[model samples]
Structures are given as C-alpha cells and as structure tokens.
Target: MSATTPPNAPQGLQNSIISFPDPGILLVLINRPKQLNSLTVEASYELDSVFQWFDNEPSLRVAIVGGVGKAFCVGADLKQWMSNNKKGIPMDLPTNGFGGISFRHGKKPIIAAVNGAAYGGGCEMAINCDMIVASASASFCLPEVKRGVTPFGGALPRLMRIAGRQRATEMALTGRPVTAHEFKEWGACNVVVERGQDVVDRAVELAKLVAANSPDAVIITREGLKMGYESLGVGDSSRLFLEGWSKRIYEGRNMQEGLDAFTEKRAPLWMDSKL
Candidate 1:
C-alpha cells in the first residue's frame, strides 16, 4: 500500500509504487490517486523505465500494472497537457507510448489489473498488456473522439483488431463505457472478479502459473508469436498511422478547444470540419 519505491528501484520510479508482491513478480501501481492516476510526462517516462527494468531483471518473471485508487488510469493529465500545449512544449512520449507499455514489444509478459474506470489512454494501456484481469466494478472506454481528439495511442487500431471493427468503431465513436463483464465477453479481459483487490490477486495467481513454467521456453514462445505479428506488420502499421494522425490532432484548433473545455469542466465545441 506504500507509494514509495524500494531502495533498489530505479531513480525514475518515485511517482509510482514498484514492489515485489510475489516471489517472481513485480507490481507497479500508478500512484496519482488525486488525478485518477493520470499520466504526466514524467510519470510516463518513469513507467517506461520501470518496464524496461522489469524486462531485464532475471528474477522477475512477470509484472502487473494497476492504479492506486478508484481509477486504473484516466489517460493523459489534461491539465498538464493544456499547460504544456500553451507553453509550446512538445509531448515527447517514449517509443512505448503513454504508460510505457502501450506500444512496447517485449518477451516478458505483463498483466493489467483493472480495478476501476480506465478511459482514453488508460484503455489503450490495458489493451497493450499481454493479459487483463478486471474487477467487476471496472469499466473501459475510449472517449477521445467526444473531446475532439483521436485515439492515437494504438487503442484504435489494436481494438479494431482485437475486438473486431464493429465493436471497436462503436466504442470509439460513441464514447460510451463498457463494463468489465462486457470486456471479458469480448475476450479483452481474461478474468473478472467482484472486488478490486481480487483483481490483482488473480493476476498474481496467473503470474505464478507463468513463472512456474520453463523461462526459456516461455521467452522463445513469446518471441515466435512476436515474429508472426511483425511479419504481418501490425506494430509498424500502427506506429505509422499514429504518427500521421496524432500530428494533425495535437496541433489542430479542436485539440485546443477540447483541452480548454475539459479544464473548464464543459463539453467541447468541436469544429464542423476536420483540420
């Protein structure tokens, strides 16, 4: 429950809870409860660093990403985003994107323990994980379109591929939230439990099962799967699409209106035509 990182943790992990909750598993909790675990620029890089550390650590077989309070993560901190945007500062997101694992390609497995509402970039973060264990109270959504912003966090393409074009399109277009049960039915979540704490516990159990297997065999199997995905050009296509789409969206007037409306606690007044 402590938010402080262990002494052995990397310097960048101050904003997160990095703990060894299981014998061969790492637990990473996004610690900004007041902000609904929003991803600030610094937090995003630190999370990426933590995941990189996890990938290299021989003793850690798996990792779980969760949030500190009611939200798993609500995506980017709009306040920070607005401030940075106004200052003409660019959002230098890592190659991994958003929460550090959104676009990451690694041999090690990671599970998302969705304990509460995961929206926008948060939904993308969960989708990026190898598996998801969600609490019954948890919900997921991609509401960026309503705010006049596109979901360039790999969520759009990946969700289309994962949940089919129809479902993904509906969710993205409508900005409606889906329950954990619905996501489980859609195959996005592996398991759904009644309580938040149980979500992490279930993920830990699954991690233990993975950790018990042959490490080399697991890595090899994952690499083979990754190769197949690469051969199909999934990663590259998504990256290229995001690069093109995000540039226009981030620099457009609608994006500014969206951020301003969000900060003012009002609905965005989107332009009639696309930029």
Candidate 2:
C-alpha cells in the first residue's frame, strides 16, 4: 500500500498488488479496495504464482501479506462462490484458496498486516501466516458456516492449535467477529497497532532486523526451535529440514561473519552473503 517499493519490487502486480524484491521481503497486497479488495478467481490464481515465486527465489527472505482499500480482504466473491460451487469446483484449489495461493507453505515467515476486517478466507490467510499484526480497526471472523460452508483450508486446525479448541470452535460455529484486542489477548495477533498508523512500517522494521542476521544461522535456528520439545512428541521433520541447511552453514561465509561481528561488538554485514 505504500508508494515506495522495497529493494527489488517492480511497479506492481496485477490488481494493483505489488511484489518488492530484495532485502528478502515480498509484499503481496490485495488491490481491490473498490470492492473492499475482494478476492476474485483470477486474483486467487495470481496469488498462487506469487507464493510459488517467493518459494523458488532464494533472494526472498520473508513476506508481508496484506490488502488494499478499507479492508485487507473481505473474502471470496460471493457471486463467484455461488457459481463455482454449483459446478462442483473445489474451493480448496491452490489459486482460489486464500490469496489464490493455497496448498503451498513457505519456510520463511509471513507477517499478516491486517488493515481491516478479515472475514472468512481473509481470516484464514492471516491465521496461516507466521505472525500477525493488526490495526486497531481490524476485526476477524469466519462466517462461512452461516452460508452452509466451512473454512476447510487450515483455519479450523490453526485456530485450534494457536488459540485453543474452544476459541476455534466458537469462532467457526458462531460466525462472530472478534476485535483486534481480543485477538491479541488470545495470542493470535502478535501486535495491535493504532488506526491510520502503518502496519507495513512496523512489519518492515521487523523484517530488516530479521534480514540483518546470518541467513544460515537463522535458518538452522528456526528449524531447531521449530522442532518443539521431546515431551511434545517432536519428530524428524525439523531434523530433516536442518539436514539440508547444515551443509549450507558449514560452507557459507555468513556464519563466520556473524561470529566475527559478535567478537568485534559490531553490527553484522551480510548483504552479499547467502541467506
């Protein structure tokens, strides 16, 4: 939504959405403010390409996913939804899912900057992200049940895992909207910002901090800590993720630079290093 692009971002993506490259952060914005930035079928498919691109491009570090206009993403176009379902189309498809890019998960973090009410799939997109920061004016809900539909795309399980089963069920079943404050209280929103302020600015501040670190170290540390606890029944998935990264760290100069910077009590310089 900001006019200024991140390091390598082009003018903008389709639907006024843009992708800023470099500095490891990709900005995926929904640009249909006139319709409250409603998600269209084409927009959804574009999102699939966006995420896929982010995953394949090694230069990308993290993503800041948000929307344009008054709301972040109001949800699917009901008009489109009615027609699509009648034909036995699957809403869970990769391009039509939240952001039109469902089914793919990124290893890097994605910070959801909820600018307004995120209903239905919008809420699902925010919840699935690695972190969420909402404006004070932001609200969240899953009203799909009211329409005889269910949020089958990861929202139900994620809410239960992150906010507890009771909260998840209450939200899904009742179709009630929750305030940003309540979301923060439930540990679902990492930061609650003020209205008219910049969630993107805050996110970029966080992004720069993350990008300044040793990429390999960050990757390994994320994999290690993400493994959770043995008492929690952690498995080989985390180890498997790390096995590939261990070789990168062993051979990368970024690791040595981080150590040297610490010894010198100076800031790390890693712009040219692999992340």
Candidate 3:
C-alpha cells in the first residue's frame, strides 16, 4: 500500500480510492457505490488507517472524504451485520467508530464533500469532519432511531453542539432527512454547491486555502480550539453517552429486528416498546 493507502485495507477497501489532487490535499472516495458506501468492519478500520496516515504525514495537511455514487453513505452495512449475526460473529466496530473519523481526535482538518444522502452513521461521519461542503442534492439524517439503534458515532453530542439541541433532537427523534441547504443553515455544513461534482472542487478549494497557511499554526489553532471545546465537558458527555448506551443499542433485539427487516425488505417491527 502507498503512504496514502490503508496499511491493511481488506479487499473491499483496497478498492476505496485515494488520490492526491493537490500538493497537500488528500482525496478519499468511499468506493462502494452499489451499497451506498455503507461501512463494513474492514472498511471502517481501513478508513481509520487512512486518516491516521494523513494525520501523521506532515506533507498532507488536509483530507477530503466523499462517496463515489448518488449517495454519500447510508451508514452500517446491514447485510454485513446480518451475515455476521447469522454466523454468530460479533460486529467489530473500529476504535475510531464508523468511517474512522467519527470519534477520532486529530489535529489535521478533514473536509466532507457530501455528494448525496448521508444517513445514520454516514451523517455522523460527515459531521465529524472539521468542515463540510455538500452538494445541493445532498441530504443528511440520523435514521438510527428508525432502525431501533442510537446514533452512537458521536452524533448525539456532536450534532447538538454543532446544530443546537432542539434541531438535533428533532433530527434524531424524527428520523427525517435534512437537506444540505438546511444543514448549512443549521451551521452543520459549511458550503452548499449546485452540482455533485462541484462539491469536491469546493472542498479542494477550501483545502488549498488552508494548505496555503502555515501548517504549524493551523495544527496549533485546531488543537487549541479542540482543547477549549473539551474543557467545556462536551467530550466527557459524549464519552459517557457512548459508554452507557452503545453496547445496548447495537446489540439489543431492536438492532436485530432492524437489520432483519432491512434485509427482508420490510418495515422494522421495533421491539423497544418503552421507547
């Protein structure tokens, strides 16, 4: 694998394209368009590895993450989850969570070039990026509630912090899709472009703008801001939520029902009667 490639990416991720479009900008495309770039365990790990590499490389100052199809990503691969469950294999969530960037703390800025729908963990991944440039057709949603799972990939806390508590609650609880324009207005997305392909161009333009600045200064500024945010207890709150609810949400009967319904092409019979 090249420096820009995932060190041990599985065959699925070996196909995840990576390219350097500028001197200090890395462009990463989630290549599984057929499945809406939904994340599998191996893909998550590979994504994490790629981000780690980008962070460590002094020459690579910024990264642009996008998907190669009509949808940016639709979240976890329910098919893969069902397969693992049928085989009695536990779901392997990467340390950095879905897409490897959700819970990751890195000084280097990553920009999401959302070309289409970003649902559930996909929405989480987009929000996790330092900035987002979304196409006009792009939409975002945390539909985990509909799937009988919580958005455990930092969506709960991060969305509330970025988009306000009321808006976040509406999104999480209603499981409704929010347009890119709406997200931009809500302060989640930074830019909204007219064309899908223009999303990448805008992201690259932003990356170039950042890359032209002093690298050390950018890193320090980012670190300082992150430190300030963490000092406000947001990080701790998110960690606590994750620890208390993640396992239950992911492993509960509700999740099973959700995946099964998804695979069976029917509506989920949610088992969480209390919720």
Candidate 2 runs further than 4 Å off: 1-12, 19-22, 95-97, 100-102, 224-232, 235-244, 271-275
TM-score of each: 0.79, 0.84, 0.79
Candidate 2 per-residue C-alpha lDDT over 1-275 given as tens digits, one digit per residue, 9 for 90 to 100: 12234344444467646656346677888888887877777777777677766655556666788888779887887777779889998555563366743333555667888899898878888887777889998999999889888886678877887788888888889999999999998889999989667987777777767766775666666656545521123557555655756777878887788888999999877643345
Tens-digit lDDT string for candidate 1 (76-100): 9999899999999988899899989
Candidate 1, run of 10 with poorest lDDT: 1-10
lDDT of each: 0.81, 0.73, 0.80
**What TM-score does candidate 2 get on C-alpha atoms?**
0.84
| After superposition, candidate 1 runs with Cα above 4 Å error | 1-8, 229-275
Clashing pairs in 3: none
TM-score-best of 2 and 3: 2
Instruction: Name the top TM-score candidate.
Output: 2
- Clash counts per candidate, in order, are 0, 8, 0
The per-residue C-alpha lDDT of model 2 at residue 93 equals: 53
